[model samples]
Target: MTCPKPRLQALLSAWNAPQRSNAGFSRVPSTLRKLHGTAKCAEEAIDTSTRRHKVIFSGIQPTGIPHLGNYFGALANWVKLQRNAAPEDELLFSVVGWHALTLPQDPKALQQARMDMMALLLAVGIDPKRSIVFHQDHIQNHTELAWILSCITPTGKLRRMTTWKTRLAVSRNANDESEVDDSLLNTGLFTYPVLQAADILAYKATHVPVGDDQQQHLELTRDIAEGFNRAYKTPSRLFPLPEYMTTPSKRILSLKDPSAKMSKSAVDPNSRIVLTDTPAQIKSKIRGATTDSIQGITYDPVARPGTSNLLSILAACTDDDVLEVAKRYHNRNHGDLKADVTEVVEETFRKPRAEFERLRGETEYLTQIAEEGAAKARSRSDATLREVRHRVGLA
Candidate 1:
């Protein structure tokens, strides 16, 4: 009998496997195939022997220590994917320093943050042996491929990207006003989506674990892959358009201002819970979290963002449905919920915190892992780049 799938395996299996079209070519679902003629194609993709094992890829910025939102929204999902992946499957998690450069960062702090991020990835159970973990900047192929992809990318498409628009909107002018301004928008931020596409394309990633906010970017990646294939691929497809694998976890919000996502840039240190937070700190933050004066607890996110955020955190920690978690807290006051949430948060973060502290000091080991991972990454991309160079007449 087939073994049971991991909790996360089911979350991603729908589109992770490639589907065969009427033309007998395996591909990700595209607008042309789905909405155009050939309506008789198979609705689902199968993992045939001809197809390679799933190559899963995702990246995270090395800004600083990740908070609750970051953990639930992405990193925790990577750990689950690693634990569940087939032995033959390839998984690459990159500390994307290049993406971090979209915004200005302190030189020394950015350096430290990249190392700390690698340590944190290890702390959270990303095995270097099982999953390829590397610094994106260490592999020059990413930038080279990004530059190649950028040459064909249309400026109109980039400008139409909601991420670009949002970044421009959030960026401040000479003054600190957070309006829809573009004076400070940099070319890096504007073209980062192409780099993102290159990151996935370099690995020929079959499935990408992405959050809802990033669905558009993944769509753009698929578009870029198709564009390159149409322009360059002669007989066979060069890149397998990657499909998105979303997390089941709800978006965790800020404790201080439930309206916004939990951010490291928030003025209040208590706004978000970091993995390194001590038990006392977790307790204080949870206890001080902004909640309603309602009679009882519920998970109406729009109506009760604060209470719902705590429940979301609790549910994530316990691996339970947020609605079900709220059922147990309906009669409880915010104080009771806060106490329980605090305990669970502390328990959840305990091991990772200890591991990060221990691993952070092992600079030699970290460097070794980083170097080895970079080599493996380069090896993986060598064939793709070789073909890319030949197609573009640079070989």
Candidate 2:
């Protein structure tokens, strides 16, 4: 199926349009906003002003093969950000292998997962040439920066982070839930946010594209940067607190459990739509997806999570408004909506699967891409690290 070019165009225009900020950062001019309003004029506006912005940094962990939640929520936003970025603007996308180690993992499997994720990112339109795509561990400076930032980052700050708490709550076995204590949590998991702060500040990224779920982490990144700056009495702020750019698509939910976000770690494999899922698999999963006994299709997330989830998936895939999509299928039975959604999903993923298969074969080429990107990333990151170290009196 063809992508909705109009929606893509609008997204690109919004991304490229100069951001209005009262906080001393640069602002997009009014002229640019006017140009962005008209689709016909957006291309020229982007071509004209694409060279003025600075750098952007965002990372994703190599946990498992990415799914629809991964794509629409994060990776697809990366593609649009890269396309809209000016020539001078640096775009760094890292497969944060180090962060993945916070949880128990098999060494060999983690390595393979990293490579698979890099290939998947490239297949989904993150251009290696246009954007610096690399493995985070390859750049020694990320760890160096993390260490320096950790010094200024209070232990209390790490304890307050929600992700670790949420993960711990989820991972507790029924029998073990009551027995678990704060002492049992690993230091790596506790310090995960500090390392994430380093990942952004190391690149001095002015903008970070993240989903709503990550807003808290980004706020902590800002707090860390500000804390370090104040403590060091630096001539200028060492790092810009990056702005959050939410993805356009609504969060995708699980087919099996509509209440939860679609996760690779979900107990049921059918709960997610993996980028690598075959057409038949896509159809089968959607066919068996849980929807209530509602006679007509409607988007009521609270009252009818299952049908609402189906509507959300269809809307995201087709670039139609969820409410509008519900109206179109208002008179239709749930079966018709499910079948149509399945067809759209299958068609949408067909080319992506083909591209992923082709790229997976070129292991050597993929390795080169990662290595080269890592080298470039290191050069930029080391400069920031050196400045940070000197400021902290480590030099």
Clash counts for all predictions = 2, 2
Cα lDDT for residue 82, candidate 1: 85
Best by lDDT: 1
lDDT of each: 0.82, 0.79
How does each model score on TM-score?
0.87, 0.86
Q: Give per-residue CA lDDT, model 2, range 166-232, as digits (tens).
A: 6765655223444557787888888989889889989888777788788878878877876886788
Residue-level lDDT of model 1, residues 143-178, one tens digit each, is: 999999999999988987877746544444222334
- Give candidate 1 misplaced runs (Cα > 4 Å): 1-52, 168-180
| Candidate 2 vs. true structure, TM-score | 0.86
Lowest lDDT 10-residue stretch of candidate 1: 18-27
lDDT at 321 for candidate 1? 73
